[model samples]
Target chain A: MSTPSKTLGDYVLGLADDALVSAQRMGWWISRAPQLEEDLALANIGLDQLGQARTLLSYAGQLEGDGRTEDDLAYLRDEREFRNVWLVERAQSDFGVTMARLLLFAAWQSELYAALASCPDPTLAGVAGKAVKEVAYHLDHAARWVVRLGDGTEESHQRMQAALDAEWPYLDELFRPVEGAVVDPASLHPLVLARIEPVVAEATLEVPQVAPARGGGRAGLHTEELGYLLAEMQHLHRSHPGATW
Target chain B: MRDWPLWEVFVRSRRGLSHVHVGSLHAPDAEMALRNARDVYTRRQEGVSLWVVPAAEIVASDPGERDAFFDPADDKVYRHPTFYNVPEGVEHL
Candidate 1:
C-alpha cells in the first residue's frame, strides 16, 4: 500500500501525463493543419498544454522528494510508466474528430483545474490557477469549432456528428476513479461531472454512455497506442539523456 | 471552401488613441476576422481593442509624392503651436 504522499505524487503525475500526451498529439499537427490560422492555433494550444505539464510534473517531482525534475519525468518515462487516459493518445482522425476530442478534453480539464485551484495543496492550487485560464480559452476555442461544424453545412454536420459518436466512448475513462488509486473518486467526482455536463450539452454532443474503461491509468494500464506515442515523444531525450539547447 | 482574404489588423492600445496597424491574417468573415485578431494580435495583452479591415481596402499615396505632400508641411511653422502665448493664469498653456 502506498503512503498518502506517494499517492499524491501519483495523482499529480496522472494530471501531468494527461497534459503531456495531449500536447504531443497537438504538436503533431503543427505544420500539417489545413490552414495557417489553424496551424498557429494548434501550436499555441500545444504550448499551453506543455506549460501545464511542466508545472504539474514539477510539483509531482517535488512531492516525491526523488530529485526528479519536470524534464526527468517527461523525458525519462516509458510507455508503461505514463498515466494519461487513452483519450489523449488516440490518433488524430480528421479535423472534426480532433475538434471533438478537444471539446471533450478541454471541458473536463477546465473543471479539473478549477477545482484544483482550491485544493488543499498550495503548490497545486497555484499551478491550477494559472492553468485554468489557459484551459478556459482552449475550451472556448473547441466549443466554437464544435458549434460551427455541428450546425454548418450538411457535410460538416454529418462529419462532426460522426466524430462525436466515435470519440464519446473514450470520455468515460476521464471521470472513472482508479480502484485503490491515489485520488479519491468520491472527492473529485461530483465537481468534475458537474462542470463537464453543461459544456457537452452545449456542444449538442451526447454524454458518454458506455461503462468506464477498466484498468485505470493510475495503474499504468494504458492503451497500445501509448507505446508509439512515447516512442516519438521520448526519442530525443532518451537518445541524449542530458541534452540541452 | 477556399481560404478567406487577408485582413490588415489595427489595434488601439488604450482609449483616445489612434488604431495602429499591427499585422495581417486570413479569416472567413468579419466575425472570424475579429476572433482571429483577438487570438493572434492580443495574446500578449497588448491591446485594449482591435480593428480589422480587408487588406484590399487600404489606399496608399505614391512614394514620389513624398516631397510634394510632406515636405511643404516641414516649412509651415504656423501650422504648429510654437507661436501660441498664454496668460500666467492659463494652467494648460
Candidate 2:
C-alpha cells in the first residue's frame, strides 16, 4: 500500500495549535488559581506552553514558505483555520477540571514529544527535544494535583473523580491516528496511559469508562469554544493590524 | 479544603554551593512543597537544586531582642581579619 502524503508544515501547525490553545486556557488561571503558589505555578506552565507554541508556529510558517509571520498565523487566522485537538479547546473553569484536563494533555504531550524527538525531521526533532523537558514538568505538576485532589478531602476527591470522568471522553481524541505523520498518535496511547494509570491508582481514583468524543479538531474543525477563544485572543492584534507592542 | 501550611524555599543555583533562601509557598506535604518551589521559584532556570522547609519549623531570633541577639557582634572588630596585615598571596581569608 502506498503511504499517504502529509506536509511537514501541516503536521507542525497542528502541534503548534495545540500548545497555543492550551497556553491560552492555562493563562486564564493566572490570577484565579485556588492559591497564590498555584497561581504562579499555573502561569509558569502557561508561559512554557506559549514558548513551545511560538517556536513551533514560527517553524510551521517557515516550512510553508508563506510570507506570513507567527503573529499573522496566530492572530489573523479564523477558528476554522486552527488545527488543535479538541481536548485543549474545552472551557476549563473548575480547579479539578483543569487539573484533570492538564494531566491528560501533559501526559500525551510527554509521550508525543519524546517520539517526535527522534523523527527524521530535524526541526521537528529539535522542537520536540526542547518541548519534552517542559512537558515533563507540566506532567509532574498535573500528576501531583491529580493525586492530591483525588485523595484529599471528601469533596475534593468527588470533584476530582467527576473531572476525570468528564475529561475521559476527550482522551481518545489525543490518540487518534494522523496519516503520514512522523509522530503516530496511536503508538503514544499505551505509553501515555502507563504514566497516567499509576497516578490514578495512587490517588485512589478509578479510571473513567466512557465513549471517546468524536474528534475533528485536527482537520481545522474545533468545538464552539474555539470561536470565543479566538475572539478574545485575536481582538487586540486584529484591531490594530500589524501594530507592534 | 483548608489551606496548606507555608513552606520556606531555598534554591541552590549550582552544585557545590549552599542553597540560599528564595521565598515561600504553601503545600500540604514536603513532597508537594518541593514541587511547588520548583514551579514557583525555578521557572527561569533559577536553580539546580531546591530546599523547602516548613515555616512553622523554623526557629527565628526575636526581632524585639535585636540588641541582645546581634549588638554584641557589632563591637567585635577583632573577629574581622582586617586587624592583621593580609599576606598578598592569601585568598578567601
Q: In model 2, which runs have C-alpha deviations exceeding 4 angstroms?
A: A1-6
Q: What is the TM-score of chain A alone in each candidate?
A: 0.90, 0.96
Model no. 2, DockQ? 0.71
Please compute and give the TM-score of the first chain of candidate 2 against the native first chain: 0.96
Report the Cα lDDT for candidate 1: 0.81
**Per-residue lDDT for A5-112 in model 1, tens only?**
877888888889999999999998987887877787887899899999999899889878889999999989787888888888888849888888898788788778
Poorest 10 consecutive residues by lDDT, candidate 2 chain A: A1-10
Off by over 4 Å in 1: A178-215, B14-18, B54-75, B85-93
Q: What is the C-alpha lDDT of each candidate?
A: 0.81, 0.89
DockQ of each: 0.42, 0.71
For candidate 1, write residues B43-68 as lDDT tens digits.
77779989999888889898999888
Query: CA shift at A8, candidate 1, in angstroms?
Result: 0.5
Q: Write the per-residue lDDT of candidate 2 for residues A65-144, one digit (tens) a residue.
A: 76777898899999988999999998889999999999999999999999999988788899889989999999999998
Error of 1 at A193 (Å): 5.9
